[model samples]
Each structure stands twice: as structure tokens, then as C-alpha cells.
Target: MASSINHHVMERAEFDRPVKILIVTSPYYKDIADEQVVGAKAEIEAAGGTWDVAEVPGALEIPTAIGIAERMSNFDGYVALGCVIRGETTHYDTVCNDSSRAITLLGLQGLCIGNGILTVENYEQARVRAEVAEQNKGGGAAAAALHLVALARKWGGPRKGVGFKPASDEIQIAGAAKGPNLA
Candidate 1:
């Protein structure tokens, strides 16, 4: 199994300026969610970063909350935490796929996000992954976000004004300003 193999976790990345991370979590599984939050907080703090958290009703809302925060807040990055276990019905697939896709779309839009939402077969698996001493998926997610932030800072922000630019000497007409013969 993947867990049986040894893996290396990189050291916490350094940033020139302070970083603030927003943690949006779905607390439907309160215990698992809490554990994830704890691990995420520890990792961020260890990297000389600060974090704020918001709770949502379910996994699906986690991404939406982050989207809102991205628009309304000045957070440097986001950490998404939640747990969705397989159920007898197909609802599990919906939650898992939608939540993950939303997070990916946000990331593609230049928002640094670390997705820690656990999609598991059972509660036992979720417990193992969420525990701070075990898999610590929350911590891993935070670290992922931190690395991305570091890379962004290194390259400066995304390229701006990449498209065509109008000639500075070109005359521009305003509404109702002139007829074609006036020029």
C-alpha cells in the first residue's frame, strides 16, 4: 500500500512577507473536521504563517465559502478541509466530484489552494487520514499551499496586460462626441 512505503515530507517553506491562509471546512463530521483544522493550523503556524477558519454545512459548500473569501478577503491562500464517506446511495459521488472540481477550478484561476477534503470508503479510513499523528492530510495540504505561495512570490504575481495594446497616438472618440466627417 502507499502508506506502507516511506516518503519524505519537505521542510516548511519560507516567505519574505507574512502569509494569511483561510481555512474553509465542512463540519458535518465534526470530529474529523476538527482534527484536520488542528493539523492545518499547526503546519501554517510552524511556517511563520497565520490562518483564519470558516465552517460550512457540507463538503460541497467548502469550495463556495473559499470562493467568497477569495473575493471579499485578503487571504494569501486557502486550505479546504472536509470528509465525505461513501454511502449506500450515489450522493457520495456527487459530493466528492463537485467539491473537488470546484477546488480545481479555483486553483486554475490563480488562487493558491490546498485541498484536504477526504473522500474515503469508511469512517476508519477517514480517521486514520485526519489524525494529526498519522497521515495528517490537513498538514500536508497546508504545506502544499505554502509551497505554491512561495513559488508565486518567487516569480512575482501572474503576468498582466498580455494582450494587444492600442497605439498611444491613435485618436479615440467618445459617445456622441463627433460624426465620421468631423475627424
Candidate 2:
């Protein structure tokens, strides 16, 4: 089983500047969500980073919340936390796939987001994963975001500003010949 297999965990990311991460969680399963936040917060603090929390109704809303925060807030990264335990109907699949997809799309758009939402077969599975002493998937997610932030910092050198460029001191017509200065 996955619980029995050993995995390589990356060391906490190093940052020269303060890292501020926004953690968006869905507390549909309050117990699980709370545990996840604990793990995520611990991981962030361990990396010398600070965090703020935002709650959503469910997994599907977590990504939207992150998107909103990305536009309105100054957080360097985001950690998405939630739990979707399988149900008797297809709602489970919809929640799991859609939420995961949205989070991926946001990441592709250059948003630093770590998806920690658990799509588990049962509460027991979610429990083990959410528990800080167990799988600690929340911490794993935070770690992922931190690494991404570190990479962004490393390669994100001076960026060009947006909007129209300023006019040059001397403006020449498009069809003007450069043979002589007609001033």
C-alpha cells in the first residue's frame, strides 16, 4: 500500500525574502480540514514562511478562492486544503475531478498553488492523510507550493512593466528614410 512505501521528500525551500502563502480550505469535513490546516501551517512555519487562511464551502470552491486571492492579495503562494470522501453517487467524482482540474489550470497560468484536497474512498483514508502525524498530505502540499515559490524567485528576474511603452526622445515616421536628418 502507499502508506507502506517509502518516498523521497524534498527539503523545505530556502527563501531570501519573506514568503506569504494563502491557505484556502474547505471545511465540509471540519475535523479533516482542521487537521490539514495544522499540518500546512507547521510546514509553512518550518520554512520560515508566514500564512493566512481562507475558508470555502467545498473543494470546488477552493480554486476559485485562490484565484480571487491571487488577483487581490499579495501572497507568494497558495495551499488548497479540503476533503472529498467518496459518496454513493457521482457527485464525488465531479467534485474530485473538477476541483483538481481547476487547480491545475491555475498553476499553468503561473499561479503558485499546491492542491492538498483529499479524494479518498472513505473517512478513514482522509483521516490518515490529513493527520499531521500520519501521511500529512497537507504539509506535502505546502511544501510543493514553497518549492514552486523558490523556483519562481530563482528564475524570475526583472520583468517588463505592463501597458504602452513611453515614446522615444526622437520620433520618426514609419516611411521616413534614414539617409539624412531633416530637422
Candidate 3:
């Protein structure tokens, strides 16, 4: 049996805002990550929001990509998607720890970041969650980013001319002109 989180969750307005998410992944795991990306894209599109995809060489690059995405200011959130299975070395620990730390820091700075990367024991475990037809974590991460974007907009204090409208497609913010003025 599963427990419900209804009492602990926020209202729909918490998830109704348009979101912009960035997905960063590892090229070494493309075979696995491809499924994740597919799942994430489907979820993002279906959720009535827009997103952008960025492919990095490896897990080590997720942090930097997030930094660049943050600077864009158009993205309301981010999603870090990757898979790191344990190998003969201790590299798994290093990657997981470092990436988690970097992501956590971004969250602390008020950027909604959804971490969907998998740190598993083997390929078998990773393959199950990365399935394109099933419950892929990539989709889960995208959902998380959307949810947090809702929550962050609520908690991100106040902006004078902010609009809570959901966007139709990927929203790329360029240089801004001010808000509407009325006398």
C-alpha cells in the first residue's frame, strides 16, 4: 500500500505556473539517458509548460550548465538528469556526492532544480528506471521541476509585474523591456 501526501502538499496554483527547465546529462550514458530525455520531454510538454535540453559530456558538467541556465533568467526551473552506476572504482561516490551538493546549492539560491539522476548499483537497476515506456526517472525529474517552479514562484517573494500564466512552448527570455504602465 502507498500513503498519500495530500495533507502535506500545496494547492494547484503551486503547479499551474509556466515553467522553463534545463536537462543536463552524460554522453557516456546516452543509451540510458536517451530514454530519460524522451520521458522528460513528454512529461514537460504534457504538463502545459516548455523546456530546453542541454547535453553535457558527463555528470561533472551538470553544475556548470545549471549556472548558465540560471543566468538566462527565462527558465523558471531546472532538471539534472543522468545515470551513474557503480564501477570497479569509487567514482560513483564522487559523482553522486559532488553533483548532489552542487544541485542543493542551486536550490538554496532560490532556483528550482529537480535532480533526476540515478546512482545505482548496476546497469540492471538503471535500465529499469530509464525505460522509455515505463516509469522513467527523467519524467519524474521533469515533474519535480514543474512542481518546484510552482512552489518557488510562491516563495520567491514578490515581483511587481509578475504574471502567473502558463506558457504554450519553451519560453526563452532575452533582454527585457519594462512592464505595462497606466496613468
Candidate 4:
């Protein structure tokens, strides 16, 4: 039944300026991570955008890395790539939920983000989703970020500090004479 489902992929985003995306990946499964990275890179390149890759120890760290990058770097968007294979322990749920929650929080703060971390029950599921020739969830994630970037560009105008006046405008007191100083 899942195979019968139809997915309608959106058209790739267009950009007037160069788009740079930072990919934060957890290489807990090195092979799977690599495949996902390849797919992400291909998608970004196809959209006339560039990307950089960052590695974290596990899925739990991916969002933290992206948050750091969002603050210290000038990337236009971010792609989160990782795999969480369900295990006997509840640690799996914590990593999956907490990482996803962190990423969502970052997005809410106006950062363009794509969440591609796969939470799968088994290695085969991760493989099918991560493989370039298969589901290519990495590419899907990149596409999601790109779409957000496009929307931000469309709806977001010049950046302004919250509750701050524009730098070009000056406030002057009425009936106050301009004088050089009496501190």
C-alpha cells in the first residue's frame, strides 16, 4: 500500500542571489551518512546553490551544530542529515525526539532549515530512505530548506532588529536646541 502512495514534489526553488547551505550530518552510520550527503549535495547544486558539510557524533548533536552555524556562519539555509535506528532502549526515542525538537525550534527562530534525519526501525529502512537511487531523503530535506529560503526571500524584507529604530533615521526632541555638549 505504501508503494501505491503518490508524492508530488515541488519545483526546485529559484534564487536571485547565491544560496549557501550548511549540511550538519551525524555519521554514526558512516555509509548511510555519506550516501545522504551525496544526495543533498546533488540537489543543492542542481538548484544553483552551494553547500558545506559538518559532522557530528550522533543524531542528537546534529541540531546543536546547526544552531551554532546559524549563529556564527552566514549560510542561507541548513540541511540536517542523520539516521536513528530504533533499538531496544528508550535512548532511541530521546535522540529522535529531542533532535527533531531542537531543529524545529531553530526553524521557528527564522532560520531556514530542512530536517532529513531518518528515524527508522531497521537498517534496511534507513538504507532505502538514504540511498541516492532510492528515496533520497537527503535531497528531500535540502529541497525543504531551499523552499523555506525562497519563502523568506519573498516575504522577508530588509532585516531589522526587533524593537529597534532604523539606523538611517534619527530621533530629535521637540523644541530642543542642538548644542555641543554638557555631559
TM-score of each: 0.86, 0.88, 0.75, 0.88
> Which ranges of candidate 4 are over 4 A from the true structure?
1-3, 158-174, 177-183
Tell me the spans in candidate 3 whose CA falls farther than 4 Å from its real position. 1-17, 157-183
Which window of 10 residues has the lowest lDDT sum in candidate 1?
168-177
What lDDT does candidate 2 reach at residue 54?
98
Model 1 misplaced stretches (Cα beyond 4 Å) = 157-183
Collision pairs in model 1:
none
- Considering lDDT, where higher is better, how would the candidates rank from best to worst? 2, 4, 1, 3
lDDT by candidate, in order shown? 0.91, 0.93, 0.77, 0.92
Q: Residue by residue across 43-152, what tens digits does model 1's lDDT show?
A: 99999999999999999998899989989989999999999999999999999999999999999998899999999999999999999998999998999899888877
In angstroms, give how far residue 163 of model 3 lies from its true place. Answer: 24
Tens-digit lDDT string for candidate 4 (41-108) = 99999999999999999998988899899889899999999999999999999999999999999999
lDDT of 3 by residue, 1-183 (tens): 112223243232235556667777775788789888888888788777778888898887898899887896578788888898898888889998998899899888887877888888888778887886655778888877877887777767866667786553444232123444454
> Between candidates 1 and 2, which one is better according to lDDT?
2
Q: Which candidate should be chosen as best, given lDDT against the real structure?
A: 2
Candidate 3: C-alpha lDDT? 0.77
